[model samples]
Target: MKKITVFWGCQIPGRLTFLEKSTRLGLAALGYEINDIPEFGCCPEKSLIKNEDEKLWLLTAARNLALAEREGYPLVVACNGCSSTLKTAYVKLKGNPKLLAEVNEKLWEFGLKLGGSLKVYHLIEFLADEVGAGVIKQRVQKPLRGLKIGVHPGCHQNRPSPAASFEDPLNPRKYDILVQALGATTVEYQSKLMCCGNNLTLAGKLDDGWRMARVKIQELTNLRADALTVTCPACFMQFDQKQALYARQGDILNLPVLTYMELLALALGIEAEELNLKEHRVDPSPVLRKAGIINEPLPFNEEVLKRCLTCGACEYDCPSARTGVMSPQGIIKRFLNGEIEELINSSEIWECVECHTCLEYCPQRFGMEKVFTWLKHQAMVRETYPNSLKSGYEMFVKTGRLAKIDDRQRQKLGLPSLSSQEPRQFVEKLL
Candidate 1:
């Protein structure tokens, strides 16, 4: 089992306990045991405190890291704000030993010294890049197949890019990848990358903050998403509680908001009733009901699909993949998007030669060959296998030949004449 530390920043432990519960439950399901630190104080709320007194912010963040450093496990954070704050401090302290000494000077009185060895990870980063979508998919007991989730990969998670080093800082996909790993579809909107303006609210710009959140909410409302998923507590509050206030005043935005951890926990088979979702001002029942039903279990190892989603190594070695007409990644991507019926119906699945060439190039040693084989099995079960394939099978059964012997080319190459008599005798005996 993998062991890690969770830095549940102030907001979650103090106000949003449900997010904590879901995160712990989900990570535990993924084979992680959290080593908690009672000494952690705060991530220091960078927006309001950092610019005013960066040293104090750095000092507090350094102290927190120092507290967790002794455990020597990678620290995972749930909120994007906390993630950015800690990472920035980590980057700053590591780059400037003088600053580290100054922070350590202040921390010595508290009997704490910042060693700066602890690796920090935002939860989405840990899930996608570390634990991997493959392991998450392997643990999924119920996939959120039918519900369309609107992902709010809040800005702080990747902004100030040098510090975070997350996947695709500008156009992030790790959140979408985490969501899709649970078997739900993610929708695109115009303001997908917009800031939630929580910092504006904290900076005494409540009206401006609400307006920014309102526009994104309205866009998603127009898009008719089943629910919104966020990676930040601030964004969650902006959409959930703030929107709740609007409902009381008769605005009634009617969109349920959830954090990525909560969705992951639910997908990992934790009951919705146990998650304390009642704390949300907006109701999550509609989404829960839509996604609550467990679909028929996957027939193959789901880890294969998860690992296959990111790999195209096989495409380089396969003749069919080189044609560019039927790429393996395309088929797996569509399959991950819950488009299996559409894919199984298309002629694309039949195009493979079952040559096992892809197995040679695949990094995981399992290749698109398994996917093609699975599709073939489904095709046979559904009577969708093409007539040409059926004729080939029948030809093999009756005469031990799929087609007439093409010995002319063989003769031209100075090969020997083809002999079918021995094969026919062998086929008769097998029958």
Candidate 2:
């Protein structure tokens, strides 16, 4: 049996204890041996601490990494924010020798030093990449067919491309693929990519954060989605408890929020009662009722991915495909076959400029451009991307603009000063 250490962030152990059950029991049911480790601290809450003191955040995360590495086990995090924070620390410590040395020096006092290869997985990363979706589906005794759910990709899981290297931050479909693995369907909504604003809300912007949550809930209701599924506890709380509070004063068309493991547990034949589904703030009856509904069977969930396997419709106009630098169909085929980690260093993905010539004539409403874009993002995460993109991404994230506007240069050129610190200040808050 494969052994993995489970990192339960602050929430699961203290407040969301049921999620701990779901994650532990669900992973065990899926053929994994869970190694329980008690000597772990908070993921250090990135927005809370990182923005306050980056050195402290990095040191804390590094200590956790050292502990996991010392045990020689793959660390699987149960929280999105925890995964993001640790990955961020990993990238910084791995890339900067000086910074790593400083961290290790402090760690030596505790008899711990950060060294050796570090492998960490957010729940979704472990599910989609490490444990193939096909393997999960094969174990499903009760397929969730006919249940239309909405997915809310939490914020921390996407930003700082290098930190969240498991998938494309822009076009993340691993969650959707994992959902479909259980025979359920996912709907696309306008607020699908919008942040739950949990961090914003927690960072003293209550109304603003709740506003984002309301937008997401409203969109999910409009589409009649059974539930809003999330991998992060903060997101689950933002959507679930906030809606419950909203119910006290107004009409919040009962929308349920389920963590990935809770849903996975159900598909694996674990009864709802066993997982304590009723403990949720918002009732999940809608999700339970919608399961296996006998409506006209919609097309299988991954129709586009499946069709791309053999269809060469988008290849004719694809400049990269014609030259044999990269093939759209081949990219799709490899992705569906779960070769994502292997494809991380592939430079040929940068050849496409997302020209929509393939979309215009394709029947699948998809194109090779879509595939290439996701690959480019993953490439950035692994730091294997071309230097040109690396600098541009860094500048944008740092200053909110690709180029730093020079007030002095503008003055020399007889142009008005075009510089503002607001962009940097704004990004600092998000950082």
Which candidate's lDDT is highest? 1
- Models 1 onward score TM values of 0.67, 0.67
> Cα lDDT for residue 105, model 1?
90
Report residue 368 deviation for candidate 1 (angstroms): 43
Question: Per-residue alpha-carbon lDDT of model 1 for 1-431, expressed as tens digits?
Answer: 78898898888999999989988888888889999888888898876789899888888988888888878899988778888998988999999998889888998999988786788898888989899988888888877766778998888888788897587787898889889999888999989989888878887887788889988888888776888999798899999988988778877888899999899999898988778988999988777755644233556677787887776676677788888767888888888888776676689998888899887777787878888887776555444678888888778866788777778888999998886677767776775
Give per-residue CA lDDT, model 2, range 1-431, as digits (tens).
Answer: 88999889899899999988998889989989988778899888888898899888989999988988888889998888898898888888898999899999999999998885868888898898899999999999767765778988787676668676677888888999999998888889877888888877787887788888999898888776878899999998889887887788785668899988999998898888888877898988656645631122223345677876678776777777787777777777787786664565576677786778888877877765676676665455335678898898889878888887988888998998768788878976775
Worst lDDT 10-window in candidate 1: 289-298
Model 2 spans with C-alpha error above 4 angstroms: 292-431
| Cα lDDT, all candidates | 0.83, 0.81
Clash count list over all predictions: 0, 0
